[model samples]
Target: MTFIAGWLPSDLNNPSNDNIAGPDSVAIKGPTGGFLVPAGATVSNIGFHSKNAVPAKFSIYAIDFTLLAETGGATTGGAGDELFPLLTDWTPQVDTYVYVAALTSSYLTGIGGDANLRFMPYASRVYEDGFPNPFVQAGTANTPKQALWLDGTLAASGPSIPEADDITDESQPVTFTLSGNENAPTGITINGEVGSNLIFVSENTGAGTETYSYEPPLIADDDTTDLVVSVDGATAATVIAYTNSYDRDQLTHPATEAEYSENSLSYPNAYATTQPYEWKVVTDANASVVTINWNALEADDGFHKDVASYATPVANGSTTVTLGVFVPETGQAYQFDRTITVSDGSVVVTGEGLWCELFRDPTEELFTELFR
Candidate 1:
């Protein structure tokens, strides 16, 4: 629930605030030599400090030197920290590379000794980048790859939970990795629900990235959760858990179907970015009670809210229900799945709902088109 956005890490040489700093403070901008950006992330802006307001060119390149995104020389200034918006959100698929240079010439210039350029226009929710470094004692500087604090203290500390998760299994092997710390985690939690048993294994059973795995006793009932990893009894890292049943129909929600009532204004969130779809299912009247639950198996599954399986008292052929209607605050899923269970203490039968394209939102008739 917090943003990982901020200035990039300062390449330093010493732990003390005043000491011989690291030699990695400055670098020339180009394809051959530049700061290496951790792969698989989206960046919107670039902020850096300069001696004075000047023009420069910044480009983001792929591992293969493929020019993914580039910007022309503009007001790339100095000292006065300025932020520049990127032309588009850069989603580097893999370990990406960055190239910041002068547009007129590759002659990158003079600036502060402790110069650092961050390709973040706006703040992004931080994923657990590393394990908590042993908290520094008072009067001591932070260690390399240590967690940071913001503003005057008095606040909860740990990794921010992600917006949403796509659960695909019942006993899913949820794992969180600490950067390079070998110490085992003290505890872990998912969606505030703690795990009964934990298995800590190295990235490959050898001395490597510490991956904490949790086989939380989750039921078949659809549940999306968050994983909270505790280091030294203090909240260190938290991530969203895609806690869904492992056993599921491989078939995805059909996108090419006419099951949804498109563009209907009846729903509360129709005009907004997400659209909700409706459907109906049948349950036995003899059953004392019946309830329904759903989950978005894929990232594209449009599930914005959680709609319980229970419907209005129906003793007839069918009951009215909405698909892709309910969603978590995180956002909507374009594809999702549903399961209906009916029981009367004697027998219980579970059925999977038809997976298909439900309502997609943020689409509206244009002003001119409406008149036309």
Candidate 2:
């Protein structure tokens, strides 16, 4: 989801063409829209596509006109979907600039290859699904958006979340911390697919540390991060690909006003605070029937009595029985059953309903709330 071009690249792609390739033409102009491999990342799957009947000069070069790589001779007719993977050991340091250029046919002698032979970033490597031979319809193919791949596993760590796990939850806010190998990512997208509008920059606090804070309301959404640095205006190298998942929807409200305030980054009201009630169950190992004790001096609005039930099958060996709660009125307050009781059926193995507020602690309203 980080736009690794796993599914689609960020290059100029318009998959529609009425004209076909013949002898030769200078179609693609990489020198204008150039790209560079960043300092700490390894980029791959860089190739080009073609539909030609003759050979061509498809090559990448450094800014100094140094030839870095070149694909083999051209095929018969440049059929659509004919991908050519370049033979490249392309590894650039902090700032290595490169461009792709090509020449097709003899009449176009001295003229570079057709720049319009859209392709993956590299040379002829074809991957087609449910399509005719040569992938393209001989004459119909879109302006190719180069295929892109980045292996961040090897790249040194960049600014990262200190807590590393921030699932969407109403009760708990998320604090993202980045330290070590830190750099300001050019851009970030968070659940942008689902229209969850929450974007902010991390504060760069000298000493290789930066931080970003999201109030619970904002943090309680999707859980994915796509960070990237610009390669060219049209392409980029992924900086950090991260995802944090926790019991964002788990029930068991905060214990105190301070706790609620800390998790939500705001003051606590009656609904946000934990309820003064108990729904507990105990069972022995491998118990068939589990009994739950329910006593509510005052039922909190955030808890739904009907939906709170034993949400697991017969107790297995040291199994956990969950107390599931559903508050449909205010889904923001809806919580999955985080409270679990270890049960065999005869006695409760663990307490079924106790939530620990595990979020960044908040200080006073004047400082913390305003910051969020």
Candidate 3:
């Protein structure tokens, strides 16, 4: 086990001073040279201490490896074997203490051995010294500073959280788009746990707004979530709504009935009318049902009254009547009389049936009967 504790100095200590000890220097002690750490070892209190006024603040830095040094080496031969380096006219300071404890398992792992070993202590400013020095050098009276040899695994770095303005008003919906400095996530998810629920509508897919319409909207540190919207392994847009709102009118409409006919007078088709009449109408939603309304009715025609009086003929049981005017199939049917009476310079028919049939080229007898 290895424990490294040190105080961060305000700046580099004065050179040529072996008795001077400041806060910025760090002391690292662990398995080095022949003194290998035991297999089952635990290291704690390994953190950075700042020499700030009032109260010193320390933060624990979780690292996988520790530093060690080798001493008493020559510039050409033993100098290269030492773990630490020696600076020009620099002296090592005291008051820096680091602890190391090896677990029983460490011995089983091959790090610990029964042979006696000797290890040297080293100090270096992490920021200036660049850790994990490849060369194992020795320290001198003038240049006693050595490289910090830290060994262990480092924590994996994770993606950063997005930052934006915080919405305080519950009624206001927060809308945002997902973006990445380089690559966007494969997919994004949004949990709508907010007041009265919120809706997100997408015009691209008619997948109207997803609603988070609960009593209290779900609070999230960040609105954007990574999600993949691509299909068939193709690229797609990353634009999505975190919170949305839409009008109710855009989703619903009133039911309506339209004009229609069964025989030759079927809907969307107009057949010749034998008598004076108005158009009939039918209406429906998603389907066409009988939709009779005042809007569907056509204006009344004077010729219709005359045709209405002609009862179903006793002989053929049907009478063919011609309409004096064009009548749409959307209103009441009318008829002109079989017995017509001339009045005011025009032959005025007594009556006509509403929505009645019209006569083709009329015969002499039919004309006489209609004119009479």
What's the CA RMSD for each of the models?
20.0, 17.4, 25.0
Considering TM-score, which of the candidate structures 1 and 2 is the better prediction for this target?
A: 1
Worst 10 residues of 1 by lDDT: 146-155
Estimate, for each residue in 221-291, the C-alpha lDDT of model 1 and write its tens digit. Answer: 23435556666545665445353433322222322223222311121123122223332122222333433
lDDT of 3 by residue, 201-263 (tens): 222112111211112232322355332222223432322233221100111111111222111
Which candidate leads the pack in lDDT?
A: 1
TM-score of decoy 1 = 0.34
Every model's TM-score = 0.34, 0.25, 0.18
lDDT of 3 at 146: 24
lDDT of 3 at 307: 23
The Cα local distance difference test for each model comes to 0.35, 0.34, 0.24
Better of 1 and 2 by lDDT: 1
Ordered list by TM-score, greatest first: 1, 2, 3
Find the number of clashing residue pairs for candidate 2: 50
For model 2, the superposed segments whose C-alpha errors exceed 4 Å read: 1-32, 41-46, 106-180, 183-372
Residue 217 lDDT, candidate 3, scale 0-100: 36
